[model samples]
Target: MKMKNIRYLSGTGVAILVISVFSVACKVISPDTGELALKDAYKNKFYIGTALNERQIMGHDAAAIQVVKENFNAVVAENCMKSGMLQPVEGEFRFELADRFVEFGEQNNMHINGHTLIWHSQAPRWFFKDDQGNDVSREVLVQRMKDHIYTVVGRYKGRIHTWDVVNEAILDDGSWRKSKFYEIIGEDFVKLAFQFAHEADPGAKLMYNDFSMALPGKRKGVVAMVKKLQQQGVQIDGIGMQGHIGLQYPAIDEFEKSILAYSDLGVKVMITELDLSVLPSPWENTGADVSANFEYQQKMNPYAAGLPDSVDNVFQERYLDFFKLFLKHQEKIDRVTLWGVNDGQSWKNNWPIKGRTDYTLLFDRENRAKPVVKSIIQAAQQPHSDEKKKRKQSI
Candidate 1:
């Protein structure tokens, strides 16, 4: 149970860097249960999960799959459940990958989360177009939305515990993104999507997920939108703040405000798609828009060789800070899911700035637990605020 000073080697027998940024011999084992797993360490606090890539789900990457089984209690499909992936050509459905993903979670006794029911990006071209390639009428789009949701949600009604029913519909400035969904159907699209999803699976938890959540404009916009959904009696269960963060931006306090704000809406606050990048960003501000792309720059890809010890210290501390915040508000938070299982398969590598080697996950490419994992486990062992107050009163 005690995993200390463990040095890992790649399949090619290259020695992976030792995770020595923490104490000389860090321990990831739970103090009480002695289980060295994220799911076990935070079992009482909240669900700790990771997004599984197709490779991991299809049994291609045995090492990553083992890491997931050992650490996470919940799994969300990385790409398979997206609208385009599921229903590429109108009525044609592709459930092979998605079916395997859900089955993997079920076999492992993990919470199965549907990545997305609807989104502007990765939606099939046919979704917003007519047979002649013109933009479909609002009425037609609405019907299409309902059909897609009902079919996808209904397919895994009782199995998928949560669905990101709508994603990134609003921009950082508290305005609608003018996406095909918004352009054709207006803001009613979100409401209708939620309604359709609820009709499909009344039991599954529905969420509105977006990025750049720490921005004041974005926070207010989501608060208002969710409030409207509540007023209209829509079945929205949670808000997923995509934690696609960097080392310095999104000050912890600013991020905390968004968490408290969303929690005030009386819905579960989930830190979904959580990943912290150690590399420098090219943009002054960046949100998780799949369309945004920048030319590959060597300057941006500085850490190609490896993340230095100095950067690792800062990275570890930042993760600890965020996890501590989640622990502080564990009552309002439902789950914290990493976007990918490990650095090797992370989407961050090709996002925004393409071909950048970013160390943006807890496990390294070699499937070794970084030193920060130990610190996080230890932090979870600390008593909650209420517990501490009671102990002080007793003293």
Candidate 2:
């Protein structure tokens, strides 16, 4: 009887150990069992989106593509839809890549946003000059702008839900960048761009997109521009605040102020190109110009090997704070799009300092959702603490 009892006790112990091991495994894989999707988390609030690179559009990056389809409800072409890639030459347009991009969005029933119709940078030399390399006449530039806007917007008419009709037009100090568009066609170029886009696709939502819009002067300039468009009877529907943020610039209060400022204009606000760079900045202040380069230094790219846990913890917290603010103002905001699908594919890796590994996205290089993914979902699931306080105060 003693021997039988000893064997029974040993079997029970093994069974309990097996059950514990299985429970631990379940907890490890529970976060992203593909059960909680970002889009669904904010379904009634606003669209969750990510920009697609060429590889994603062509179905080359299967893992990235799956994440996009499963988590995002809207899509924007990162570069393929831009002027440099779409119409590199004069009067000749390439639509193969852009077409595939649109098709991909349609297949997934995602909201499609045309990145930019007119911008100072990334435009071919032929756009602003004649055959003899002289600056094109005002009439010539206007015609070129109209043709490009009509062709692009018209092709994707009724499909593209919104467009960055004019990008980065306002400078940080409440002045225009004096690009060839502003130099030749004057400030009214923005008005014309909006009119032409409206004519091409009257139903599509047109937006003016820019970075550093959270700054006071830049926010004022954008508000003035939108007002000017409205007075001219132009159909400007939204403002895309390009959220190329850093660790400590543009305080949360400043960002929230801009959201209120833009929303006061009665236009939908979008958080476009959202990425937070963990590396050090080369200059005191910089714009998102790809041509903006800085001297490479070891200190600049400290995380060249990998992000330390300490830095990553701060990064995740910053993202959580921003998403919480976004949820609080979901009524005015229309969408929040991560700049890229994963950290491995982020533009921050090459900008300012080339050949640097920077982790500026929600997904890590392995294409796995980072801890911030759970935080954002939780933010969406529960009322913000501020909201709870407001409710109690009202009572």
Candidate 3:
């Protein structure tokens, strides 16, 4: 969840072009390169997608869709109409860019996932304040929430495949992360938000997204909350685990438990905002000033030195392991969308939470696919290959 300063000038804006950097950068096999890992991980499924904006959708960043066409089965636009992009002004709405993004997905025949109808971050300033800077009333906030959801979702009714109706609402310890929306709307706001989104786009799948707290207590909380919502018939549809992993923290096993617990609700589960960073690094933290461009990291960036070439190999192996775990639970998994596209476009590169350089993402700064790309593609093309061998030997 990092951001770079991008100016949206008038005119044809930026000419977006999509290029394939896969064939040039990564060889299917090298004469002396490391052997391929994960014989078979993703046999019957494939969904390789990255987050996209207006410039990215039309501009020359075809790496996302190229991977989709080659490997991924789904595509998610990270911030299509967050408060900043859609309702920068209270009464006014903007859809020129969001419309174009949807059109691109429709034209390309890609499954479009609309990221975030509600979030504690990246929202408009006017959302919390009145003309004289007074906090708006609860009733007013509810109306505003309904209006925004109505206008946005009503516009894209059947077009969007899934909506992250709520994002990052929970804290690392599994409690509400207190925001203006919560202040105005209260705890019930969660239920209300989903209810409104469901009313607006009945066909679009609705998901509640959060990060951290993958432990059983966390799982218990999510399951309990979603279950209550289900009991109320809120049309929750799914739960999104925002797989923002560091070198450690929500250990691999914890992630597995989350997948199983959320899927027990008989709804879909998606890895929404996914990026890994080797920590002891600083990341950007923004508040109040929307135009702020401060590099605020709690620690130093890990990839300051050029990432070692062999580390690239380690990255590929890690991808194999992660995908294998996902494939093992493929029955419960519905989609896995990368948080950003390339090293250059990732927030990990600049502002607040810089990972120094290309610490995350499938492609490097040049948009070339790395060993990670190869490992993921290989796994997706061959699901259960390893399991089959084991079963055969037993027979």
Candidate 4:
């Protein structure tokens, strides 16, 4: 699809401008003239997925579900599968919401990814403390980890195809985070998490997920961890580079380097938790930390009403560029999952800064596919001779 003579507008007018441009520019005749499904476009390359929230899982958001069914072939629970939400108390599991999420994926015939089996954040408070509120012993913590993984992984063994066995364990400076799992169980907790996940459901692909993977230090740390797991026969299948990005950060070259680095380890690379936030960051190096908080400022939340057309153009181009890079390295990349379905449901709205409107997804607040969707499809369908030449020159 080609957009011609596009004009930039501001605020809520961005969507209107996009729709008008698409109406005129999307003239290339293809099988579908109405709405192009992303899954169909990238079916041959890799799985296209989105993270589903309770609204979509419980069938409350019919339009979002419809969009999900049409565009995505894989699904991951956004918050339902997290430890805090899944099992809030010791020895107790809450499978009602998660079960519904898995069923939704099954009903749609989509590849299901368990958002996380273990993580530093979102874990229940009781998981680390003993009866007296002191830190649990190594043995007790290890046992707790085992039980949690076994129950969660075993319940949806065949239905879930992939599991984020461990999430965000390494910090950006090539060091381990001082999470309870690390403090008590030591560095081996990651290996144990993968092992328990593998034992519970041997068929599911186990992955180590983290943000800032493109940073040299974090990438090296993750690579070392993966190699160690491989040496120990831990059965790790992939690495999830959380693609929570913005307009300026994580340059394309750096992202490509991380992908190639992980792929070199003979593991599939998944662009997980993918979202491009258009809002300004409070700090220079802030990432997608759910726990990180920032004072709300009106200037920071500039697009509360709507994203400026210029910002919308930047968002579209940024997504197109990343998709182009993914397509260029499709052989190494197994899946690319949007963090959420649409702008309205994005975690960016409340993360780091509360009540900020963020235009960080492919679909707008109204569930209409942005003009960038067509651009991505076109990028996937077309060949990249320029990239091929660059690769040859580098070789």
What TM-score goes with each of the models?
0.91, 0.90, 0.80, 0.89
lDDT by residue for model 4 (299-390), tens: 88998877788988888899999998999889888999999999989999998889899988999888988888888887777767665787
Best-fitting candidate, scored by TM-score:
1
**Cα lDDT of model 2 by residue, 225-288, tens digit:** 8898898888999999889998887799999999999999999999999999998888775567
RMSD of 1: 7.6
* lDDT of the candidates, in the order given: 0.89, 0.90, 0.68, 0.89
Q: What is the C-alpha lDDT profile of model 1 across 1-395, one tens digit per residue?
A: 22342434453433324443332366454332354578877888889999988888899999888888888999999999999999999989999999999999999999888989889989999999998999999999999999999999999999999999999998889988899999999999999999999999999999999999999999999999999989999989999999999999788999999999999988999999999999887876467788888888799899999889999999999999999999989989999999998898899899888888999999999888888898788888899797788899999
Error of model 1, residue 174, in angstroms: 0.5
Task: Output the better candidate (1/4) by TM-score.
Answer: 1
lDDT of 3 by residue, 42-156 (tens): 3245344567755676656665445434444456776656867889998788788788888877887777888778876888888878899999999988888899888899999
| Candidate 4 TM-score versus the reference | 0.89
Clashing pairs in 1: none
Which should have the higher lDDT, number 2 or number 3? 2
Question: Which is superior by TM-score, 2 or 3?
Answer: 2
